[model samples]
Target: MTQPYVVRYVGGPLDGRVDSLPATPEVPRQVVTYVHLHAGPKIVHIYELSYAVEYGCEYVLRVEDE
Candidate 1:
């Protein structure tokens, strides 16, 4: 079956080099397990080389609710 999700190009700038699984509105920060980037019948798949998350400053401020 065709996948219900799709990857879109969101052009912007990050503080440093950043690369990870394709993200969607529902799964923000979700590391992608696989992807198909080619158009039409052809397809491509990509998997994570690493799983990562930030645990400092930004994450610290949000911990008060916990």
Candidate 2:
């Protein structure tokens, strides 16, 4: 089986070199795991990665209220 594609966030508040995960929109737990392993604990969102000219998203992380 192919490994799950790692989503990359671009533009917006998350410009670059800012390891700050905002507290507004809670990030998904699974995505958080990926981020914690890769980006760290300051990343909030993980959108689906796209290579085509037209953008597309398969699925996004959604954390249940705790």
Candidate 3:
């Protein structure tokens, strides 16, 4: 079965961090496609990521804009 991307909030002023999925290598990889902000909280800092998936072990890099 296709694995779903996982989202985990590490910690931050803006809700939290986002972690991609596969959960583990054993599962089939999946593209994040996009992060639809269902509900954006009021915060000072926030980040966004977007792109296409062409291979395995894809990553969604995140860094502070400031």
Of the pair 1 and 3, which is ahead by TM-score?
3
Clashes of 3: 0
What lDDT does each candidate get?
0.29, 0.35, 0.42
Q: Write the per-residue lDDT of candidate 1 for residues 1-38, one digit (tens) a residue.
A: 43332333222121133333333245343333233345
- Candidate 2 deviant stretches above 4 angstroms: 16-66
lDDT score for candidate 3 against the true structure: 0.42
> What tens digits encode model 3's per-residue C-alpha lDDT throughout 37-66?
446853333333333344333334345569
Considering summed lDDT, which 10 consecutive residues are worst modelled in model 2?
A: 15-24
Measured against the true structure, the TM-scores of the candidates, in listed sequence, are 0.19, 0.21, 0.24
Q: Is candidate 2 or candidate 3 better by TM-score?
A: 3
Model 3: runs farther than 4 Å from truth?
Answer: 13-42, 47-66
Best-to-worst order by lDDT is: 3, 2, 1
Q: Give per-residue CA lDDT, model 2, range 1-66, as digits (tens).
A: 443433334443332322323332344333322343345556555433333333222233344469
